[model samples]
Target: MTISPPLHLFEAFGVELEYMIVDAETLDVLPISDRLLHSEDDLPVSEVEHGDMAWSNELTHHVIEIKTNGPHPTLAPLATRFRNQIRQINSQLLSHNALLLPTAMHPWMNPERELHLWPYDYSPVYTAFHRVFNCNGHGWANLQSMHLNFPFADDEEFGKLHAAIRLILPLLPAIAASSPWCDGQKTGYLDSRLNSYVPNSRKVPSVTGDVIPEQAYTQEEYHRKILEPMYREIEPFDPDGLLQHEFLNARGVIARFDRNAIEIRLIDVQESPLSDIAIASLVTATLQRLVNESCTSISQQKEMEVASLRTILDQTIQDGERSVITDRNYLRQFGISEPQVTAQEVWCKLFEDSRKQISASHPDAIPSIELILKEGPLARRMLNALSEAPSIEELRTLFRSLAECLAEGRAFHGL
Candidate 1:
C-alpha cells in the first residue's frame, strides 16, 4: 500500500499560560485561576467544563495554557486569535484587581489546597495526570507558553523540521525564563517552571529502539525517535519517578499540541501579549532561521553539539544569562580543570557563535541575534525590578506593570 503523509506538521498554533497565583492571605500561591473562581458565568476554556463554578483548561490547558482550537494558518492570524483569548481571560481576572503574569516558576506554592478542580470536572486523563504530575501538592507552574508545529514531508523535510525543533529547544528558556522566586524568596532561578515540569514532563529517557541510534538525526526524527516506550496502564505515584517518566512518555510530541504549533513549553506566563509577541517572535524567527537549509540538527551535529545544547538549556532555566555561566565556569572559578572558559563568556559566546553561525549559514537570521544582544535577556530586567521592590507586594506590582506594558504593545525595553 502506498502511504500518504500524515498531517504531522500542517502547521499549528497554541498558547499556554504558566501562572504564579498568590494566596489571598500569604500571596504564597492560592494556585487558583478559572478553576477555583466560582461563578456561573465564568469563561470556559473548552466545552469540557460546563458547571456553576468557574472552570477552564481541564486543570492543565487553561491553568497550563490559554489556547484556541483551530486549523488556522500563519502566525499573524493565529496570534490574533490567541491574543483575543488572552484578553478575554484578562478581562475576567481584572474584576478582582488581579492581573495575569506569564511566568514559568512560582514560589511557596501550596498545591495541596489549590485544587485543579474545574467547574464541571477533570477527565480521567487529568485525574491520572494530576495525581503525580501535581505531586507534593505544591504545584508551582503558573505561566504562559506558545507552540508551533510544522508538518514533516519525507525524511528530508523531517531533517529541516527537526532542525527547527533543535534550534528552538536550547533557546526555549531564553524565550520565557520568568520565574525568579521560590517559596516567596528569590530562588535565583529565572525559569523555575522547569523544576515544576520536569517532575511532570522530563525525567523520562527516550527509549532505545530496535534500530540502533543513527549517526545523523533530525528534529522531526528526534521527536518521533526519542520517546519512552509505551507500557501497559502505567499509573503515577509509582515509588520510582519512572511512573512520571511513563506519563511524560505517553504524552509524546503532539500530545500537548492538540491545537497549535510546536509548543514552546519553556516560558513562564507573561503579563501581556507584547511580552508574548516579542519573545515568541524572536524564538520563531530564530527557529525559522535555524531550520533553514544550513542550520544544524541535534542528531547529526558536530562534536560538543549535544553538550553545548544541553548545557545552554539546563542552565538557562535559572539564570539564562548568569547561571549558565556559573554552571560552565564551575571549575574555572574553582581553579579546577575546566572547559577553559567562564560561564558568562560561555553564554555570550554560545549565542555569539550561533550568531556567527547563522550569519554564515543564513545571513537573514542574524537580526534576531542582534535583537537579543541589544535587549539582553528578560531575566536581567526582572531581577533589577525585583531588587528595587521593598516588599513582595511591590515585586508583584512590578510584575503586573511589566505585564501591562507588554500587553499594551509597548516596546520591550520601553515596558
Candidate 2:
C-alpha cells in the first residue's frame, strides 16, 4: 500500500469502483483483464496510472478496479472522471469482443468453472489467500464493490469516524444492493455478494469477526483487539507471513493505518458511476452529522452493540429497502422519532436532512439519489424488469441495458 501524509477528518476522500469484463454478445466472464491493462505491451502489470485515475487488477482476472490516483479534496468531480475512464477502457475492450459490466455479481457465472486468478505482480498475496481459503467460489471470483475511503488524522479523529461508520453500515445495503441474481437464479438475497462475503474467510473466523466491526476506537485498542487476533489466527496457515498485514482484517469497515484512512467495503457497485458517487456523497454528509453529534453523542454511538448492528445488516442484505426497522433505539441514533419504519424511510429522512450538504458539495448527484430513493435500489428495479421465472435471455437483456447505462453515464430506470 502507498503511504501518504495524514489528513484531517473529511478533508479529502478516496473512491474505488470495480467492474467485470464480459464477452460482448454472450455476457460471460472474460479473463482478459491483462489485455485491457497492457494493450500496448506484452507484459501485464498489476496497476496502471492514467492522469488523476488508475486502473488495477483484482484477485480474479475478469474483475477490474478503477480508483482515484490519490485522495481528492472533494468527490464532486469524481463521477465524471470515473465515467471517462470507463469509456476509455470500454473502447479498448471492444477490440477483444468484450466490454465492462456493472453491478455486484455476474448473474449466471459459475465460479467453479470460470474462476481464474491474476498471475502477475502481487501473485504471492493472491496465492496465499487461495491456499488458505479456496478461491473457487462466488465470494472470491464473482463480486464487485465500491470502496469509500476517508482520512482520519489521529486517534481522536479515528474514534469518532469509526463510531459513525458502525451506525451507518447496516443502512448502506438498503440503498445500494445490486446483486439480486447469482448462479443463474435469484439467491433470495438482495445483496448476494455480501451474503457470500461474510463466510469467505470462515476458515479463520477472527479474520472477519461478524462483518460489523467490534467496538475498538483508538489505534492501540484496534491493533490489540482486532489486528493482533486476526494475525495470530492466520499465522499457522500462512507460515511465510505473506497474509499478516492490516488488510487481512476483513471487517465491513476497517482502519487502514498504513494509509491513515478507514475504508467502508459494504457498498455494491451500481450500474453507473453517477449512482456510486451519489451514494457516497449522501453517506459522507450523514457521517458528518453523526461526528458532529447533531443527533447522538460519541459515547452513545460507541455503545451500540456489534450483534445488534449485525442483525440489522443481515435483514437489509436479504430484503434491501423493504426491510423494516422496529428497533426504536437504533432509529433514535439517527434522530428518527418513529417507533417503526422501513429501511427506505430511514434513508429518505437522512437524505432530506443532508440535502443541503449534498446539494452544495455534490449537486450533480441529487437526481440519481432521488431516483434510487423513489424507485428502490438497482436490485429491486432489476427484479421489477424480470418475470417470476426469468430465462437466461431475459437476464442477458437486463444486464446489457446496464452496460449501456455504464457506457452512457446514466441511471437504470426500470422497464
How many clashes does each candidate structure show, in the order listed?
A: 42, 0
Residue-level lDDT for 108 in candidate 2: 98
In order, candidate lDDTs are 0.44, 0.95
**What lDDT does candidate 1 reach at residue 365?**
31
The number of the candidate with the highest TM-score is 2
Q: lDDT per residue, candidate 1, 244-303, as tens digits? A: 332244211232322223333445555444455445544554455445434343333322
Candidate 1, run of 10 with poorest lDDT: 207-216
Question: Over the full model, what C-alpha lDDT does candidate 1 score relative to the true structure?
Answer: 0.44
Off by over 4 Å in 2: 1-5, 39-41
- Candidate 2 C-alpha lDDT tens digits along 1-415: 9965679999999999999999999999999999866635667888899998999999999989999998989999999999999999999998999999999999999999999999888889999999999999999899999999999999999999999999999999999999999988988999999999999999999999999999999999999989999999999999999999998988999999988899999999999999999999999999999999999899999999999999999999999999999888899999999898999999999999999989998999999999999999999999999996799999999999999999999999976
Write down the RMSD of all candidates, one decimal each. 7.8, 1.7
Tally clashes: model 1: 42
